[model samples]
Target chain A: MTRSVPVRVHRDLARAITAIENGYASFGDTLATLPARENGKASFVVGVTGPPGAGKSTLVDRLIEKFRAGGETVAVIAVDPSSPFTHGAVLGDRVRMQRHSGDTGVFIRSMASRESGGGLAPTTHDATALAAHAGFDVILVETVGVGQVELEIVAVADVVAVVTVPALGDSVQTIKAGLTEIADLFVVNMADRPGASRTALDLKHMVRESGRDVAVLQTIASEGTGIDDVMVALTAARASESSNAGRAVRFEVVRNIRDAAVRRALAVLDAPRGRSVLERLRAGELTRLEAREELLVYALAEVINAD
Target chain B: MPIKVLVAKPGLDGHDRGAKIVARALRDAGMEVVYTGLHQTPEMIVTAAVQEDVDVIGVSILSGAHMTVFPRIMKLLEERGVDDICVIGGGVIQENDVPKLKVLGVREIFDADATTQNLIDGIERVVAEFGRARKRTGAATPAS
Candidate 1:
């Protein structure tokens, strides 16, 4: 009922998001039609990730309030893990951000890590672009906090804000979850709790040892402490460097291309000729690798022709 | 994509074991379930449901405040004009109270003894019906 106004103005933005999430057949091409870099005001993407229960959601809640107060429209994409088996996700991120529900300046979408090769959902990049097209100034990407294995946000966000909490074991080992490098800024959430200062110091030391000049800030996100500092650090980082700038754009392009290719490959696999190849593989008439190679060769040719 | 459901425990229901279980069941059944942690007001739940664009809301309340809680949630949804969202209640509800809850616009009520499969099937049926009804009325999406 509280329609994010930009979505109303852009008209197609909401429909485009629905199209992407619903897996409309033309979403691959729809990505091409979207405004990529150099075509519109580039929206800043901040990726927030860390261990589960580290208050990433609460941090995001505060960030939304701060960003909204600063007169900047915000969009949030909370990426939750889809069941590896059922492909369904409990996207509880919006629950943590109930404050922004009626704020027309903020738009929130919960996405399942569906079908995408990376930790993010297949439509995440497209969703971000839709938000950008809808005129959101700041975009926040919240990952499912999977350690090490889920660094896909690295390729998507311009600035990655890694969050951690106190008493979360050795700070260095915590950073070992592959966050040691991708973090443009580190936040020690729940700083109101004991050991917060120690955790912050450990993060500072680990960041220094990693040779990344990232700022480590402490925030009691539950009570909105240090949100302004986090905002300042994020803004400074966005202006200071282009760590994942061109990378996010290029990755999106290639991802869309790859997704299109996969869809085409699936279509080919459902064909009679492809079915014969599958039958051969099933009967051991051809090795799995050999059949895969043949399918790839056929699918690639078809993809090129389609292009 | 599967239908998205927001499972909320509005009010002071600290005992969210049933809510959590229902959320997990919905997820396992391939529905996206957003479980709002513990304490929440009707406003918070409705706000979250709208923001998440959920097709169904599975509210679990065992605090014996269903008479007040269910109506408030229904009123909030009505005020927000988000009638497309199917409301399904589950918890310790007296059998005689079922008609009252239904009159308040809850699509269905599930007792504590309801099976996981029953909840899933009921949610799916209501959501499917809502989708069809929306499609018929050209209300596939909420009004902007």
Candidate 2:
């Protein structure tokens, strides 16, 4: 690739975001400069995720309105699934919040979940950091919300709200197995619809049975009902910082190291040895466990040696 | 980086089937499409483009107001000094109006009958051209 003249970005918010997006050489230095807590307030990150068509966007739209009403500046990072072939994604989350379009108090950015496991874009943490550094009081990271495996939001978000709808098969098992453990709040959105209460009740029962104190809230996001309650719950979650601070810190640190290694590991996995291991497994010459062990050893050695 | 296109339906066009179709097509073609939901004005579209930092602004107008809408959008882009962003139009346009719309700074006007492939190809070409121009001028590349 030919090198072009460097373009200067004036605003720190834009500069940090562009640097992370482009993976510029200065990204690490730029990230290091951002203050963890700005303006005496540790910026709160709230993650809203659930299966697709669960009204996550609408829920986020309402949450933004509520946050803004409380005199808080809000920044939204909507993570959408990327196309496997071209690594592109349709970022339509802003369409749901058109009323907030020209409002200077709110900033909405749509991000593609580019090659990152757990339904988050690799740049999500950097973007949230920028939003915090720019003095946004509340930063909402909305996940791709594809399925169970997209639980990476918990690693970055201070509060993780899983928004689920009625009629998703075996809701109890799905929630109990995956979403239950990580969710700071479980929301049964579109609560006005049929069977909404049933879903909420089931979730409430599951929460009780699991021995965790996570809140289960019901919401009709389009109508803007139950939004205030959700906000109140999130405020409480944010206030109880000491409880989750250690976990959050560990998550951030481990992810910071793992993210860089994962990118390189992926590159190695696409190389010749990785292909041969996969072919062996497919041909029944090697068991899945054996192939995984071998590939892990090779990739781990490569990463460790590089360091 | 994927190309970002803002699909705006300007005016009181309640019919958004075309806009939705085109937005999905652009997404399927490996480009990000920001659909400014229906009933947008020229000002709203331009403001969206500026905020979203899109490379292409595609206006879907079926309210027979292309002549008024396209010029106003172009004027807003000029006023903001964001003339580098490519403009395209579609929906309920008369055959002869294409020339006038083009004169008003619309790079290409696709008719309602234009296939999704045609829209995709036209957008890719325009976005590529705009990118080259931006690079030559050293403008900060639009966010993908």
Candidate 3:
């Protein structure tokens, strides 16, 4: 593997991330060459996620200020949804954080969630790892506006802050399964709105009932109000042993294995030998399930033989 | 795998209608467009381009600061030792200043008469040129 770019250089770090985003053939080698964290202190990754129009970006912008003021080098990975049809995206998350553009202590990258259903771009993990390797003390990952089940943030961040706004109608929206389970802290951003206290209270009550130690903080992110408390809560959350630590590694390994298997299976299906099974199915000589099993067998054989 | 372009409105121009339209058109044409909203400084724009590692930057300057803005951006990119990212300009520029801006290493200047298709085609062309340059020197070497 050729390691041409120095991973610690800012310019080279940007290039390394681009290589990962574009799936350059040797990007893994570049990542592999990055020095491991010293003293077991890797960059702290904070995942900020919420529904559309929840001010996730605005809150992230404020948090970036708070983190930077503490003198930590911060890197942000903001992901936006790609058009399922065109695979293109208009990444506007940086508009709110544009003030930090010239600040050398900050590095922000926008990514389009192409073919990744997880609210994050496919290469977000790789990019975050590269940023950590580049020696950032904090990495803030802002996911695409999410709904109930974009729980992939749990697999990446040391702390997951789920930002929600007030007057979301039914308070039941707050207790939904996937999001509530993953949140280490809940931020009622845009807290100046009408139902701010009520929303916060509901969340607090829900957390109490669930017997979880989750902290709920309120903030009008646009005004930079209540941000300090939110930051404090985040610090506390980070101090706690994350339940996702072991699960995250296992999740990544499983995902990688799944991706590789899918690739190999596709390769087998595209080849003549595997296509014959499809032909048999098409000719009514084999059932769909039978053909699928035959293809899986071929794919498994290919995977085993390659070893 | 996709072409990434940064569309920014630099200077005091509040007129982002043109910039937004171009960004939307680019996105619809299968390009990832980063729209950095209004009144961005040249420094901010370049910082964004470098951090985003965008293949091209489309600066929309209707503030008549083209003479000041284009040169500053070009100089900044040069100072940063970044040549791979292409810079293009659009919106309310006098026809006579087109060649002048191009001389400053602005890849292409699209005026009012230039349609969305023209802008898109021009961007794709310049991005392809940069891609070829990168290929020739190897991807690790910055395109000179």
**Over the stretch A46-163, how does candidate 3's per-residue lDDT look in tens digits?**
9999998899999999988988888787889999999999988999999999888767888888999998888998889888988887778899999999988887887789888999
Q: What is the lDDT of residue A201 in candidate 2?
A: 79
- Candidate 2, residues A153-242, lDDT tens digits: the string is 777788899998875655546455766677889898888888887888788888888788889898889998998899889999988853
Candidate 1, residue A98: CA error in Å? 3.9
Q: How accurate locally is residue A176 in candidate 3, as Cα lDDT from 0 to 100?
A: 70
Write model 1 residue lDDT over A154-235, tens digit each, in one string.
7778898888888877765745656666788989888888998988888888877878788999988888889989999998
True A-B contacts kept by model 2: 0.30
Q: Pick the candidate with the highest lDDT.
A: 3
- State the displacement of the C-alpha of residue A167, model 3, in Å, after optimal TM-score superposition: 3.6
C-alpha lDDT of residue A117 in model 1: 47
Q: At residue A244, give the lDDT of candidate 2.
A: 59
Cα deviation at A259, candidate 1, in Å, is 1.1
TM-scores for every predicted model: 0.81, 0.84, 0.90
Judge candidate 3 against the unseen true structure and give its global Cα lDDT, from 0 to 1: 0.84
What TM-score, to 2 decimals, does candidate 3 have?
Answer: 0.90
Index of the highest-TM-score prediction: 3
Worst 10 residues of 3 chain B by lDDT: B135-144
lDDT of 1 at A294: 92
